[model samples]
Target: MRADGSERIVRCNEMMLSLFQCSTEKDFLELTGGCLRGMVIAEDYRQISAQLGVWQREKSADAHYLDFELCTSAAHVRRVDMYLRRIEQDGEAFWSIRLMDANMRTLMHVPGAMDGLLSRGTFYQEALRQAMKDRDMHVFGSHCPVYFNITNFKLYNASCGYAAGDRVLSHTAAVLKEMLPGAILTHLAADSFLVLAPANRLTARVEQICRRINHFIAMPGVEVKAGLRFFEAGDTSPVTSSFDEAKMACDAAKKVVKRSWAIYRKSMSDRVVLHTYILTHFTEALQKGQIKVYLQPCMRVLTEKLSHVEALMRWDDPQHGLISPAAIIPVLEESGLIHELDAFMIRSVVKLLHYQKENGLPIVPVSVNLSSLDFFEMDPFAVAEEIMERYGISHEYLRFELTETAVVRDKGTLRQALQKFHRAGYHVWLDDFGSGYSSLNVLKDYPFDLLKLDMAFLKNFNQRSRDIILSVVHMAKKLGIHTLAEGVETEEQLRFLRSSGCEQIQGYYYGKPMTPEALYAACDKGTYSVESRAESHLYYHPLRGHILRQIRKVDASQTAQMMTFSAYGRSYRVTMKRIASAQALHIYQAKFEDITEELQYDDKVRQTDDVMRNL
Candidate 1:
């Protein structure tokens, strides 16, 4: 249109005519009745004129913008970005106008040569920006932006080739255009699309479009699942967020065979946020002492002795208190952080051993778990040896527990690593033996000193389960491997396991997992034993009178709070005695006595000789 008030028709370029699917300028002009105003929709003509009037009145001579729907010569309507600049030519005023088809702009953003649709990356980004700007205005009536993608496009490309994939994309675009006329459509990425239309219309029509797209792309070893997320007019979130949410939905859809579509939800986003938080803070948490090592004692069922303690990792964040291993270990494993965490646990166990020796406490062998990633991080046995040696601890004081999953992940390397542990004189136990499908096979191949049975077998106590456990125990014993029943929380279960010849039992019924200090304290108390006092006079009121008589008989110059007592015809050692005065004449106070077993070998030998002589 001319800048002069006449609004005269100007020359049309051949390319512009081609965009309207016209062969020649004459044909296009005839279709529009040879008038520029006739090319625009009748409802938008007045606004276009008013905006033009404002542009002319300003006298800035700058290019003015008009975004309006154009009714083209081919009887098709498209949104257009028109740049109108005022100019003077041949001593007269005119307007140089450039028409940019919104559809073509979208197609331009696509990477390849696309016809009849916008697939250009630049166009897709611009469309998103424009959609966001329009949404911010809150004037685009009840419209929603929907994002979708072809789920199996990669498989299709891999099987059929890129040319066939391109055709599929073209066919999909054509179907979408026909189904959703006047929609603001943009091809987002390789196989994803964004469409803006009336909310009610989109919700009603998206399912049908998905069916058509799936059918169009259907082939042997090829399927198309569409995942869609709608950004409703009432939603205050920006349009850019739609892609991520929709992508998540699409991924979720891909996991289900029967489902072809999924909608984004808040819970999915929350899970993503949590996973990201754990991954981001893991290293910092380890350095800040939030990650700790705890011990759970594995006791021998036959001897009721503390065989060893298993080292388990725990996280206690200052903000989110006590994150469970079930919650944090997966993130660590997935993020490859488990390797470093496993190393840290090994070092912590070594430090615990060192601490026990320094404090004159009994040094117990501790077993630490290793991840499959630990092998990739470094030589597990070598690392363990290095830490133990650095702390001046022996390899005999440490053991390694490897899960069936970790061992099966890389059998060759892990087997080699396990062999190295054996060579280093450290016990390598296969943990969670029956948790995996390959447990029996793992047992056959790997050289494990012990088999820690998975707790699942004990969850539902039945005769069949019992038989299965008995068979496993029998097999393990035949293979010269001991079995440990984990999660043994009942007397019945403990009795059944003991009868089945399981070597160890570790669970709540025996004891729960405890800190180093608590474990040390329990071990310091040692095992309890029952004895009978043959002489009732010394045993009467044994807590006070007997202990007081023994302490009074001890000479302070000869012994330091030490005395000997006889019980069951054997002597016992009493130490750490304290005495105080009592108000009653026959009563005396005795405190802080430790009575331990002290055998009378000479008395037993003389009794044996007298019995022989009598016989």
Candidate 2:
């Protein structure tokens, strides 16, 4: 083939004519329009031209081999392995070429002037064949094959729109090709890509590529991370193994802090195996009594008495012995099996309540935790009601506790359940009140019986945290809601909570969770104190301007009288006296306590009657 303006074929043998589907050299040239590009696919002409230009610039002494798709006269694409070199013939340079099929056995013999170039025994033929055999294995050098994929690709596609995701994929392809030229690329899966490059090349550049991908995607709630599996030179396994490892690495990368790329590790495989085993056996374990409820006591801070016990789930796997709830619950919740486990725990609590009642023991409130999944999976109110009915217990004995995050996630769905529970006379306490983003907002919107402060805050107990806790407690008090402190493990914490007016405390210092028999024994020993049984009278008067006054004695028939009282740097005054009296007792009542939202005062006073009636 001549590298000229016309790109004419200088000469061709019978075999070349046959391959081009022509009878003679002149006939083949005429059929191909006397242009070399006419016999090569138009799409590949630019790459081929670049390769030729590079070879010509180097003035290679040896023949260089290239694989190209050749278009024959019959319009059929032939895979051609060509060994060509620049030859100066008659002071006009042209390409001396030997065309062979990819197999290297059958020769599409071009009529070359040099007999050495055409000999099958030539070392160039062996070198070309060996290079072709290892073509897919090496990129620029004796490098490795790495499998990579964008993390959460489906999520990105769904959230960012498929068209945008497609653009991202296309942009990534172009960047990879441009940045790492000569790297073999393959699209193995929808989001997975394979690149054959030196291990060092991939390791040094993958992070940059992943960061660029993440930046380019730039969609909210859509992130991109790449995982890699590098193959050494000696690896003989199929390329799919690298892809599988890359997928595993991608999952592990999600847990890596601030990292966009991860290399495959064996621990990832172990975790995946354990997760799979747990998910497979969770349901059966629940039925086999392997999953049980553990009770933790919450005591009244002032009374030093048991107020309620939080029902916590624990797994006692036969093979694994005791599995921490922390270890299993998350997997169950993610798998949506927490719904059944929650139901089991609820029924178990009800049965325990029934057992306590039958045994003539004190039946304190048992607060069972309900996951956010419960509301969406089934009617949580109906579930609670059914358990109460099955055990023939009152709803008052069963208090439901939900995490702040759960309540905030689906306020409408949970609000309906909360309203139903309120109507049915069940107390709903917001668990881990200050552990989430919208604690105060949730407090303002949701009607909760109690707020359980997370113990995590008490771990430090610095001045700032103390102030925050006291302020939260004061706010809850002002709202007529009680606050309970969880994870209290020291006398300092218990005393601080008691001094801060926290209503309840639960922690390791009091006692670890006990079995049913142990709890029964502790209850009999008065493990919690009862409030003093004495009742006394105090003068009370309602003021018109959000105030109250206390007096030693006032006439029951007295009319409007203005009196002032001061507490906590706030002043209150009595505006009217509307009293009803017994023979030796005087009664003065106000619609609310000292702290009230005056704007909703009248409405709250009205609703209080209805709420009390329902209770």
Candidate 3:
């Protein structure tokens, strides 16, 4: 349909030429179906002095205003003009003001693509880390993500051919753009690409955008590792100096994941109180002797004696103390300080190895865990080799554990890396076997000398369910794979392990994780010490005490004056009082224990004087 005289309607791209034929506003309005209010402007008109004014030729100060009239069809265009108001100001003469909308409410600004990118990126990575800790396999975020910075991706070689790699990148990028509206692609050179560029949103908010991107990219069936990096106020790094930082974060993310996309996060200059607390205490713990390595003994099923030791790292924070490796490793990984943590753990283990050798106790295999991020971000095999050689320990003396999922990714590189360690005389342990996506295939494909049976399998194993447990155990035995039963707790478990033909056992039932000195002494004892302080402490307190201590501090806050908090594993209620003498608040906290105890007491002490009858 054509417009009448007044209104100019753009129905489609191709109708412009026919649209110009209707010259008059009334004709334009008539041709189109739209209402028009009175508005007028005349453009490009010429005027001349061809007037029959013989009378005005005498002494006329008349000049013809011959100019093209500026015309616009917009009505009330004058109302858009700006005006400065003379109002009270402390140091300025003008007061800035914005008129309210028809609803008389302040307008809310919508964040653009940049803000979305930052926020989603943060959320995606944090959620990924959380998922890993929780062992929530196939933990899909609310949003799938776009993947980028496939560093050494062609290194996969089998599934994706070299020529198809570029198509994969472009196809992936295009698919992401189609999935996420208002997203852009920025090439940061090489295999790196920045997708989901947010508008107006701050760098801090980029996590939300990254998460949305991840949500979409993963929805289409294939799993791809996406690397993420986030930039803030002023990260002097060249990659983040401009749009390329996103690509660099993409590149950095590939260090943690070949298929996972990442949002770039520059080192934080500004810190939240919790972050500051973690960082400060972590640094202090590292500096002092507070952070230490303890060994969880792995026993040979045949002898029911020690086979190896898995070195577990623990930290006692100065502020909120006793940080779990589960808690600290993740923060370090997200912060890109995980490499430091890995190095610290390895170095600590190596130091213990040296001390053990010096005392001449005949060291057995010492297994250490490697983060998935380390395999992608830092070459753990290389680090492990160096640590082994530095400690003058044989390859047989070492066993490095990698998650089945982490090993499955870039299997070629991972295999080659593990093979190198194996060749160097170190054993490779496929930790958490029979728990992840591909247990048998992973064992078949990768070179693993030992299989660290996940605690979940042991927890599930029962004499009543002997058929299921025996089948799995027999399978491992037939394959000539050494299976270490983790978290073996009772004598019954030991008897069950022997009956099931399991050759390795680890847990409190055998001997708990011990420090270097305690381990040496216990090893020299000619008997096993199955009970550990951690278990006894855990019996009284399910979680660490230091965590509870920190919860108390939160209640001390003026804004958050009471501590009524619930965590995934624990809950607490607290109150705080400021101590003028100490210049700090004293926090009083009660865990669920107090409430349960009080309830138990209340039931018994029904009346105030009822205690006499009970006595």
Poorest lDDT segment (10 consecutive residues) of candidate 1: 528-537
Residue range 1-615, candidate 3, lDDT tens digits:
111221223232222212223446444443222211111111111111112122123323333222111111211011111111223245422222221111112223223321223232343344345334423444222222233544344453345565555455555455545554554444322344444333233233344434554454343323344443333433233222223234334434544533354554543121222332343244445777787888888765533456668888877655556665655664555544456676678777777777767876656557888766666667777777787787787555566788776776654767677777777766677887767887778867876766777777667666545565567677876775667678788888776666665657889986777777777777678665332222222312435344445455655553333433334334344443332222232323222222444554766778756877778
By descending TM-score, how would the candidates be arranged? 2, 1, 3
Cα RMSD (angstroms) for every candidate in the order listed: 22.5, 23.4, 30.4
The TM-score of predicted model 1 comes to 0.55
On residues 1-615, what C-alpha lDDT tens digit does candidate 1 reach at each position? 576655667778976687556788887765554454555644355567667778777766787787655544433345577887888788777778888865455345333333445454554565466676666787543555566678657788998899889888877777778888766666755677766655565655877887787787877545555545665556666554555566556656766777766777766565444444455466667889999888888876544667678888888888677877876776666545578888889888999999988998777778888888888867777778888888899776787888888777774888877887888778888889888768877988898988998898899989988998989998997887868989889999987887777877888887787888878777667641111222212322344354545556543433336555655545545553333222321222222222433244566788999999999
Tell me the deviation in Å of residue 375 in model 2. Answer: 1.3
Models sorted by lDDT, best on top: 1, 2, 3
Model 2 has an lDDT value of 0.66
**Candidate 3 all-Cα RMSD:** 30.4
TM-score of each: 0.55, 0.59, 0.44
Could you say which candidate leads in lDDT? Answer: 1
- The number of residue pairs in model 3 that clash at the backbone is 73
lDDT of each: 0.68, 0.66, 0.49
Residue 12, candidate 3: alpha-carbon lDDT:
23
